[model samples]
Target: MLTLACSWLGMQWVHEAGHVLGALATGGEVERVVLHPLSISRTDLRTNPRPLVVTWAGPAFGVLAPLILWGMARGFSLDSAYLFRFFAGFCCLANGAYIGLGSFDAVGDCGELLRNGAAMGELWLFGALSSASGLILWNGQGRHFGLGNNGQPVPFRHCAGLAAITVGLISAGNLFFGTG
Candidate 1:
């Protein structure tokens, strides 16, 4: 349970860090990243077309972070494999849940994509990408860590509960922090 929560928080940080990296890559100034209740970035930039890229970058990096971590962890000792696996799996699940659960109503990368006229298929594509990546990472990592086959599948109710927790945390953060 501790590992699960830590993995979730790590993925959130990586997701938000993706935004910061995108801002820097696109010539925007990043003020800070808040990681208390949720991960949000404060940036200084002008309104322009780059916001779309910046938004997309979050999930992009979110998906990429675990992959990179997993790849890098390959050269290390096996004892630390669980750490990489947990983080990678969390990243995939976090991004996947954010999209697959329709939690990105009007504020996330998907919302930005929709506002910019992205087709529903494109949004579904994003969800598919994250879901597949997450499943692959989770299953693969489980195998690598000898967690055995025939693991118990997470039921829809559990997924819904997890989604609710995520949404609640973000909502609380936004309410208290003003979504800056």
Candidate 2:
């Protein structure tokens, strides 16, 4: 549950950041971005000439940021690198489902993309690829979660501490920086 909470907030921030970046890249204006913890994240544009690009950026960057972070962690030979991979996979799965399943109702970013000339087939393809990637990343991660045998006992206390820290930091960030 702690990881889920952190992942939720992280996804919202990264996805919104992607929208902001896309808007700025296209010479558009971003009017407001809502990042409330209790609400779904969104970036409202004042002027958008490339809505499709902006819309695509949300999920694209959401998945990419975590993967990049995981890659860097692995490059450093970090012990907790699997956590980063899990986070990346979580982001991908969340974003993919948000785009794929939500397409049925033409909701959220999916709706925006479609309205801006995105083909349904393209959206489904992205969904399939992203979801598959996320699952692949998650494969063989059962040991970390204490489901598999690694010849040693899992550190429950350490995991709990990490979860606590994640919740605290994420909640604090949302309470502070997300208020606007």
lDDT of each: 0.65, 0.84
Compared with the true structure, the alpha-carbon lDDT of candidate 1 equals: 0.65
Q: Per-prediction TM-score, please?
A: 0.68, 0.87
* 52-100 per-residue lDDT for model 2 (tens digits): 9999998999999999999999999987787788889989998998888
Query: Top TM-score: which candidate number?
Result: 2
| Poorly placed runs, candidate 2 (over 4 Å) | 151-180
Per-residue CA lDDT of candidate 1, range 1-180, in tens? 535755665676677778778887887766555555444333334533467777777788988877887778876754455557667777886787776555346545667657776666766777778887777766655543345674444445545644665666566546643454
Instruction: Give the Cα-based TM-score of candidate 2 against the true structure.
Output: 0.87
